[model samples]
Target: IAEFNSSRKLIPASNTKLISTGLAIRGLGPSFRFSTRLGYSGYISNGTLHGDLYIIGGGDPTIASGDRMTVKTDSLFAKWTRALRVAGIRKIHGHVIGDGRFFDGPIENDTWSYNDLGTDYGTGGNGLCFNRNIQTFSVSPTTVEGKVNAEVTYPATPWIEFRNCAVTARPGTGDNLYQFNTDLAPVAELRGSLAIDKGQKKESFSNKFGALTCAWEFAKYLEKLGINVTESPADIDPYDNIRYTEAWGKDSTRTGFRYGNMAESPENLTLVYETKSPSLKEIAKVTNSRSDNFYAETLIRMLAKKRTGSANYDSCKVVIIREMDSLGVDMSYGAQIKDGSGLSRHDYIAPEFFCRYLKAMSASPVFKQWLYTVGIAGEGTMAARLQGQSESLKHRIKMKSGSMNGVLCYSGYVMPSPGKPEDDMIIFSIMTNNCPEGGSKVRSFIDGLLMRIAK
Candidate 1:
């Protein structure tokens, strides 16, 4: 309210999640849930499925998160195995296919930097997102100085290979490891140093080829349960990679099978296993509170699929812009929305635009659900922020904070103080971009600003 640059286009950082999450709750409906269907496209005559086992993707990002963003591998997959057994399917003579057609976009957004592609924050959104597109590496220092070795990856798969070039530094040196790889590239390079720890250290890295990697792991799981997958992931993934990459101009090579197309019919094939993700409410909670880039990107694409029948990035942007227009928000406030995560430097939005969206959302039926997704005064990214506040103020301030390089942003709802009318709560957005002093300084400035506003 004082000395503000509300209309300046600036990088929103992760605060953009607020917009994507807000719009998603209204556009997709709070009750909407992402569903993944499992069906076998084959005949089972003598306890053996003669045709392919199909795993169709429904743009569900929580398949790997299990329930509520925690990994629940056994129960869900066990249901599939049990269903297969009950259906009299013991042996599968064909390939285990992953159908990712629900989403038809490039694995990596064009606006995302090449440097951000393969890290935990950079994992591309997929029609079939498993384990949140992440793989954890357990690392320890070797006897030799300046060298560290990595053990096995969790939910291990034969699809990805790692090249360890990490160095071990003296204690208190801290972690300096870096990963390099293309979104769907088969190999990843690990570089940098970590402070030597007597105890093994664990780090989670992202994979661009998560859908296929997850399918390969599922195939191995089926193999353990007496089912054989005759076809290798090399064959299936290349076919899929080709299909997804063609739109991005990364590959033009023709492939045999169209993995995105629906399998023949459910009558001929048995429904082996089906999984439904947490509702949109929970997903948006994780997106805004945790600042989950993958989920944010996935939600936008899902909206695009709902409106345009295609999950590409362009469609998503168009759909989002159109929705804002319908809501009477100025499109010029955020002239362009390149990616859902706000990871792209090309992304630009004015703080006024975010506040307008938040204000508009507050009037909607789903406003409570949307508000619940943001971090409260002392949770998630808001931890240690707005500390020592009055009890009433603590519960009333809900915000989503975003910081990337020189950009720091916060946007959401701040409820009314005691003695104030309930409707007096404010919707606000503050973004500081290109701050030479970095995130901590900008956040300190924001805290001071909030205190002044509160008084």
Candidate 2:
């Protein structure tokens, strides 16, 4: 119904997921599923395996995430343990290796701010992701009034050391705790303060070494199941391996070298079991609804790998541009896609692009599935928004919201009336950058505008 500065590019924040998720739905299909495999590199004789046990990653983001749509960690580990027992693997004579070479290059986008790198939402996408690539800690204020106690509460991170530097603040001050650590760092420092009245709370931090963490957790689970593993869990760091570079060099076309091709594994590797992730449609729903950065990044990487034979951020950018062009969405007007999740301050796109993209998606064959993935009233990021509005009005508004320091954006479709057909839907995007107003005020303004539109 309106247009203002629509062609001007601005920071999109998590609204970038709209593009990433759409490309994923179009390129990978709604029914596509990611697979992670458990196999051994050596011969199993009697009751002992002579070589490393491998968890070959397929870049599945939902493994052990404990979401309503995904499996829990302990249950998944138990299933793996049972599979090992059924395979007659009473003992492992070598290390449990996490082979995460499915997706290559830096785990995180280089443009992402360092401050965000340590937080749970800032966690990078990784092959063989487990527990959503997050490490949770239980923190409580101490009796000393100035000190707090914190400890790792999940995935058994024996390899990591935590130094609690958090303090106890006055009542009603709330939790201000933050974790400081680099990617794959063994040490993490917890800094900030928690209100004494808040008691204990759970804080989450990014887990960059997802593959290694997964292997470590599984090895520990096996030990608990009376199965002995000789060596500690280890991960294959693609950046440090000479063979990785050689493999890339060998594949001049960069095709058939990653994702599904397990050429890096030993020829005699024995398949134990394989796990399949929820469909891409389900994953996209979670991504858009929750604004999940990890899921968005992984989906884009998977899309790049499928279309371009490479999974790095650069390849993902290329694939996105090509796909948008195919949809006749002009991105030439100062659109910059730095990362799939829009975690990077470098990502910029015009409001027009979002509307055009939404219109294009609405015309797609999978439009219903894509529409179902978006957040509605009282759901995901939209749960607390439009509070006083009627249920019918609220339900008529479906969109994805994006917010950061001074950025707030909403992009999606608004039904013209209750039970309206798809053709009658109105596509819209509102992007605000460097707004001086508080988030709550900005959100209220946006909500009012959307309410009017819905009516």
Candidate 2 residue lDDT tens string, 252-368: 222111122233353457899988899999999999988999999999999999998889989988988899899888777649998999999999899988888888888888888
Judged by lDDT, which candidate is best? 2
Candidate 1 Cα errors over 4 Å, as ranges: 66-71, 143-145, 169-173, 196-199, 230-273
Q: State the displacement of the C-alpha of residue 130, model 2, in Å, after optimal TM-score superposition.
A: 1.3
TM-score of each: 0.88, 0.90
The pairs that clash in candidate 1 are: 64-131
- For model 1, how does the per-residue alpha-carbon lDDT over 34-86 read when each residue is reduced to its tens digit? 88777776588888888777677788888767545543776777877787888
lDDT of each: 0.74, 0.81
Give lDDT: candidate 2, residue 191. Answer: 88
